[model samples]
Structures are given as C-alpha cells and as structure tokens.
Target: MRYSREHKLETHARIVKKASVRLREKGAHGIGVADLMKDAGLTHGGFYAHFDSREALVIEAFAHAMDRSTERWRKLAEQTPPQKRLASIVNSYLTPVHRDDPGHGCAVPTLGAEIARESPKTRKAFAAKLEQMIDMLAEQIPDVPRKAARKQAMAILSTMMGALVMARIAGSSDFSDDILGAGREAVLGRATSPKAGKPRARKAAPSAPH
Candidate 1:
C-alpha cells in the first residue's frame, strides 16, 4: 500500500502546520522530533520521508508559522486605512495577549533568537521570509520610499521582539507592562509621526575664520 504524491504532500503540510504551532508554544529546541511527530498524529519514522532532517523540518515549520502570522497582520491592515495601519500593528504586537500566546503569535518574537544559531539554510529562510513580511507591512504606509518604509518596519519588529524578550526575562507583570507600553509608544509615535519622513538637520560646517 503506497500513498499518492498529492496525499503525501497533504500529509506533509499537515505535519508542518502542527509542528509550527508546537514549535512556537515550546521553543524549537524544546520539542523533540519524536514528540513533534506524535503530536502531528504521524509516526516518527515518517518524518524523514517529508524532510531531510529535523533541521529541515524546523526551517519549514518556522516558515509556516511566519506565513500564518504575516497573513493575520495583512488581514488586519486590510480592515484599516494605511495611515493607521502601522500603529495598529504596533499595538497588536506589544499586547499581553501576544506575549502570553506564542502558538499564534509572530515567530520573530518567539523563536527568532534560537533560529540565529541554526544552520545557514535555516537562517537564510528566516531572512527571506522576514524581508517579504516587511515589504507587505511597508505597503501599508502610503507615500513612503522603499528604503524608509523598510527601515520603519525593521524598527517596529525589533522593538516588539526586544520588548518581549525583556518582559520574559524580568518575570514581573509590572515591568513587563512598562516595557511593552513604552516600546509601543516609542515605535508607534515615531513611525506614524510627520517626522518619519523629515530629514535631520546637520550642524553648520565649522568656519575657516581669519
């Protein structure tokens, strides 16, 4: 008895989707290949048929999780106009709900640091997906240049990731709230302000006085 290629591909997709959720809930390093397989309702040995190794699965799963997260953000953007989208994105990213629920949250805030230590292939996948995600976010800001939009998106991402890391490390709700709120204010205020497009004034050149 053999499975058709379409069936195999469907099974692989199911496994990857389940693995992505589990990977976010529990850090990627925390979940064993066997456990992930069992959680996916598939036999452990079947894992090799879909992916070359656990590393391969990890990268795929990360990509899957990222895509899910990005789609959610895009949908939110669709409901709002461009002028308000970035602020909405920042507020959503910094909430306690996003902090407490890793399974459905962005991969960058959950497992990005761990992915950095992974193989170049895994890192490259993250980088490529990250750029695509940022581009989609940038599209929500009207009249902004590509480079400026990219920079704003990167800053928003960094602030969200950094705030979550600090909140997790501090282990205090008060501190966590402070970190999240401050980060949210800083990012949203700066990114949405008119100053976002204005160039900084340079100091006057020193005079060659006689």
Candidate 2:
C-alpha cells in the first residue's frame, strides 16, 4: 500500500534519525545500508524511496545529528550566564557520560575523520553544519570581536574533538577521564580568560619623516 505525503515525510525522518545514531556508533561506511534500513524498521528495497543514495542518507543524517548538538548547546547558552556559557558548554561536552555514549553524542569527533574520505557533497554538507556550530560557540564568547570569536570557536572545537577522540582510544577509564578533565580545564580556561579571544595588534610602522 502507498503511504500519504505526510507519512512518507515521517518515514524519511525516522530513517535519517536512525542513520544518524548508527553512523556515530559505527563510523560512516562501517554499517551497511541494509542494516541501517532494518534498524529504521523498513526494508532494504525501500531505502531509495527516501534517499537517492547512501551518501545522500549520510549527509542528511550528519546534518540531523549536528542540528541536535547545536540545539542542545543553544539551550545551554540560554540558561547560562553570559560569562559562564562557554565553560558550561565545555563541561557538558567533555564529560565521561558523553565520552562513553558515542551513539547519541556530537558527530564531529565520531565521524569527522571518516567524512574526510567521503564525496565532496558529503564533506560540504558537514562543513556547513560545522560552521553553524562555530557560530553558536562564538555567541558565547564574552568580549571578543566577531572574527576573534570565530577563531576561538574553531580552536575550542578542535581541542574538544581531539580530546574526546583520544579519551575513547585510551585503554583505561582513568586515562579517559583524565583526558576529558584536562580538555575541559583547557578549553574553559582559554574561554574564560580576559585575553583568550583577543586578536594581537600589529606593530606600528616606523615614522616616515625624521
């Protein structure tokens, strides 16, 4: 039986949501299309009805996961004081709970390396979402200029993602916890410092006349 337009849209969203989780849990290209469809409660043959290709599904899923992450950060920023917003976000992001649960956490640390090998369209989609995340981060920076805030956001994201990846790779829980703690401190310290996001001023040129 054919489904109505709304039903089809809902089904499509379900597939993307399931794909988003599984992609983080088992890297892009780790799980087969059939498995993703099965987890979505649909048959393999029906996959094309919702997405043109696996790459398309991946791009959509990546965007969905990033959107969830951004929304969560936005809420955290709204509830937090302007001065402490970055610290709050960093603490929330680097916790052991988030570290242990890759399936439901942010996609960047989990899927970023794998995405580098993907098609241009997929990488472009990821890049766009990443910029949105940076913008959200920039908003939390206290006194920095816009350009400096964006730069700081990039550095903060890089540090957080790297630390999480290392934490996951470590053999022991203590090491993982250490990594998370260190990362939280480092990011929060930079974020809260008065000079953290300030751009360096250029030196004045020597006077032309004696």
**Top of the candidates by TM-score:** 2
TM-score of every candidate relative to the true structure: 0.85, 0.89
Per residue, candidate 2 scores C-alpha lDDT tens digits across 93-207 of 8765677778999999999999899889889999999999999999999899999999999999999889889988983366676676678668876322111112224222111
Candidates' RMSD to native: 11.7, 11.7
Name the regions of candidate 2 deviating beyond 4 angstroms: 190-210
What is the Å distance of residue 29 in model 1 from its true position? 1.6
Residue 166 miss distance in model 1 (angstroms): 1.6
* Model 1: residue 61 alpha-carbon error in angstroms: 0.3
> Relative to the true structure, how large is the alpha-carbon lDDT of every model?
0.75, 0.82
